[model samples]
Target: MRTQQFSRTARSLVAAACALTCLAAEAAAIKIQSRDPAGFGFNDPTPAAPVGGNTGTTLGEQRMNVYRYVADIWEKNLDSDVEIVVSAGWEPLACTATSATLGSAAAWNVWRDFENGKPGTWYPQALANKLAGENLSNGQPDDGTGYGNVDIKTQFNINLGQPNCLAGSGFYLGLDGNAGDAVNFAATLLHELGHGLGFSVVSVQTSTGYRLNASATAYSPTGLPSIWEGFMYDNTARKSWLEMTATERRQSAINPLQLAWTGPNAVAGAAITLAPLPVVKATSPAGAVPTTPYTASSFGPAVPRSGKLGVLATITAQAGELGPGCSPFDAANAAAVRGKVPIINRGGCTFAEKVKNAQNAGAVGVVLANNVAGSFAPGGADPTVTIPSVGVLQEDGERLKAAVAAAKAYGSRTQPGAVTASFAIDPNRKAGADLAGRPLLYTPNPLIGGSSVSHWDVSAVPNLLMEPNISDDLTLSVSPPKDLTLPLLKDLGW
Candidate 1:
């Protein structure tokens, strides 16, 4: 992450001007340059059947096509004279039976103080090139180790969905949005490219909240801010990142829902892109509990706005860690949980498994309590799990537990409707946006490296392309009326 600062140096400006003059007059194009070696990665010779509007006949060709398609989408939405080059490849990134790094990308380099750029703000290489009206990169071939002529460097998981590598979930090369159980390759590309184009900040250490210095060699308390930080508003601190100290910025990064994107375009985009967040509200407990936010499970039917009203109960495990509710509840536990919404601890099993067991135990609805702090929309699909389910943060779950215990101690479960609650969408609050219609950034406590403070909050309805997680519901659209990515880019002066 080098931040090359431009000056009034005639030599540099003339070089840039010469590069721009050499290009043919045409709309800016995003070029996908393969960085893979022969017989592997993007060069793999494996045969592949065309599917979902993708006509490539080989594995590598299909992967390349997805990249090109994503690039074309960005090119169509953006205006620039200099062509943006993305160096992309495939590699065996981290993978497991449950999770995998489908892909990752970042700006190859950053620039500041360039022509038509904000002073003291670092712009990503591609965006910098657009603003400067010239190609500023070294224009060297990439070997997957360092930055060069490329504006963005990206790589995907080659062994994905193979044995021992997220075994059952691989990349779907289809141009159509029907990814089914596999990850959508084009959607992932769109997301990574957004980061490269300008969606991410160049924080040397997010925990310290330090941006790269002018030279970009290291982090500093007085370092230049990334253009992305200009829109990072901390509602709790009542200040934007541009107005905060490093210490204050660090605190705001972990403030969860407190950090929001204050860009006007994003704010307007959120109004149409996001829906009201679904939450669990305890009406009987009233003043005893706060309205709790939840992430709806992708597997079940959408949580109804009408709400599911029931007594909240906890399931007991015959044997397990913290009663995760991995296995079916026994007869006694079933009776206790029957006709109620059971709050099951996360982990020990898939969300679908837990919900299916709760449904079998006669649960009308379910709440999957986070085993850890923070919240995420629970993934996986199970057609048989008919009851709706939502996820609550660990602390929120604790609050619910305490409320239930208090109510239970005071009154009988059947008599006064103890622990009575309803899980439903709250029309007052947008899912991933603040009350002011600004979209919340992913600012989890304890800081999720590469995720926190960079991507959109996962609670976003319809799932924006810039969210940390690649959702199954994302479309190719990156502009307004359907998506917020292009709007946000426009905010960054795209």
Candidate 2:
């Protein structure tokens, strides 16, 4: 990613001249030129204007407008003067009979038409070289570097099954909010544009961490290193892309708190109110309060609840209740479980089964103790559970368990501390820059490929419009105070 440093006075002048929303006139309005008009397959050549837009426009025309809307947003804010090459037409992007991919975008002509001297192949990191101005001989016309020479491919799925915007029917084609009537193409297209603009890495992810697909043995000139690597930081390992192990880097892709984007442009003009994560505070009778971080259970209701959790000394194992806590379970001590949070180990069966057993024994909530080191969302299915649940670090679990034992041995008064804890959503405040002044690229757990490291965490507060999954209840936006993506583009020398 590149950085475009501006003077404080210059910024102040722009802020003064334009509303916080945007500049009165774009510094440079990047054009969106269409490709292969015949491929779009529209008869009229002109599509309708979208909902609330020019009413009499054609569907094909309406589709182009949405693409342009996304392009306009990028053109208005990005520091680039180059035109974005866009192709918006219908194609059956079906992976199956009923499902299809919505769209995709990427840096173009940044790769060699051939791989490793092959006549027609390209490595993934080739784009990084172009972004870095390495100008590697990729068998394509040199477009210089430090900026994109083409538009991000904002393709759509015009599959046969859905009355969706991409299909030119079910979605509201305008740049306005939908009343649950249609899909919001503007939001979806913006996300794709974000990727094309460098909100992605070409590193290959594995079951563990990520590895560079291409070897980098040089620095400059030959374009040995990928510039995108400089931005990825793993807080868990307290290391950047260069310092992490393959497994460490892979985990960073999903380790919400660990993964971050440390680029000058990303955090530029930074003002964040990060949504805090829930803190499990254990108040002792001694008036001491100790808090620990936790991961919410994947299954069960999202209701955040706080109260005392009763611990059962019995630990369960995986394999659908193979160990203790099985039916006819002696672990279901009514005295220990009735109406209280059931704190138990995460093992012996599915999380759903474990919670089901707890609920059957009168558990008001469930607190799972992690057997692994770092915390992750507890995975299991329990659709009928109405109570909230959470997972704590093993260390924290041990302490909480011991406290329960102490409470059992002696009365509440003699236990020395309050045994209650609170489990609820902790909307974080924005993650400020680390010591190096690099901002974070937060993507929450249950990590997905293609989506990881490419977008903000889904749970991020103040609404991260770039999360992998586009919410139906979204409106298009691209500035800070509500979004951080535009600044990232500027940092990449957009």
Candidate 3:
């Protein structure tokens, strides 16, 4: 989508740091420009009882209250003199019985060559105006969309939580952090707003690896970079996105765990907020692998450091089973897996389903092997899955299968087991970060549009508010020690 273009109005502004310092002296004013018609979106008149520190008596009023509340949080964290306007509304976005698009937001415009902006680098409209100390969004004719004066554009799903539309997962518009089974509307809003305010790539296409031209209306071979790209460092290319070519940036987008944010503020915040990563340590069967990093499943209990070690049992397909362990194990397979940790292949069922099957079979823990070649974090909610579960790379799974087969063939594999493993935390390395402690950006093998390079990697411990998926345990805080959103904004010159 093209960012709305505006004719830049001349303004005298100080240098970058001094401009930011001057703006940081006062609180910002965030204005929500309602895009919906009357009696709709923020104007709906449906009656609603007060709940969770929100006093609005109508549905739309409650929604607006949450918007203003989240806006106040960002306003306090950001510094600006000109009113930061966000064009927002509620609409029927994409939804299904189990999943839905909660909302989407991005900069309504991008600017470059401004008084305080880095030369040839794009800045989001709101931040651009703040740095330049003038409203560049004004004095533009409505290109028929009525978004000429807006700095950001956002929308949410109005039909969320309804039947057939992510049924039972509607937005909970409460100030309290008790979302229960419902989605926390406040946290979701805060995350999307973070993107609009500056936590997003302005005009780079992940699929094609092409950057947007100065006008941002089409892809260009020689395109200007955004301020966000200045911090993206690719270990494979040994260069930052600012120093790499378009093809190199495209290749780095799928480099997985090699693409990291180099922003000092965010890197520092990660040291405070992130924890050591969880891994599987093969402790038995001499010559077994030492340590293998794994992605913890969202469905099961966290992998503990000790007390759960056992033989690494490999599952065989049984009669009536979908795949390896897609269904309940038979007598023989269950017996072999009993009191052991079963390594199941991914597919034919949900991660929760496989882990639940393992738990029911008396397994101490579960290791999920990827069907594909790259890394992935499994996500699903299952309270019955009490066992610790983690996913390993495809190559690791193949090695485990070979080792199990070879060991079981020999008599020495009987007593202490062919392979024994347990989960452990590598205190030397941080979760979701590189060796230097820089937080990894989301860069899966196949690109996920709007999620691939724009958000933090999902493996982050403590579950950041901007990690593509929303965790129910998120709080209102957006600064360091609790979150890294504000620090990243600071890196973007907020």
Evaluated with TM-score, which candidate comes out highest?
Answer: 3
Could you tell which candidate, 1 or 2, scores higher by TM-score?
1
Deviation in Å, model 1, residue 305 alpha carbon: 2.6
* Consecutive 10-residue window with the lowest summed lDDT within model 3: 14-23
> What residue pairs are clashing in model 1?
139-149
Ordering by TM-score: 3, 1, 2
Best lDDT among the predictions, by candidate number: 3
207: Cα error in model 3, Å: 1.0
For model 3, name the residue pairs that clash: none
lDDT of 2 by residue, 1-494 (tens): 11111111111101111223442235434456554356363323554534755243776677676776677776666543333444345565644432347667665433322212211112232232323233343233424542333434445666533643233334456777662534566787788777766677633443445443332321122222233555677777778865666666667776655566766545543444234555566644434445655656657776354554433333334344463344433443644566677677766667777777777777777777766443445655557877777777777788777665554433445433326666544344333333343455644455666766676654344446676666654556666666777665544434
Q: In model 3, what is the error at residue 216, expressed in angstroms?
A: 2.8
Q: Residue 259 CA error for candidate 1 (Å)?
A: 0.3
Candidate 3, residue 40: how far the Cα is off, in Å? 2.5
Which residue ranges in model 1 land beyond 4 Å of their true spot? 9-27, 138-147, 285-290, 316-319, 330-332, 371-373, 409-416
Model 1 whole-model lDDT (C-alpha atoms): 0.79
lDDT of 2: 0.53
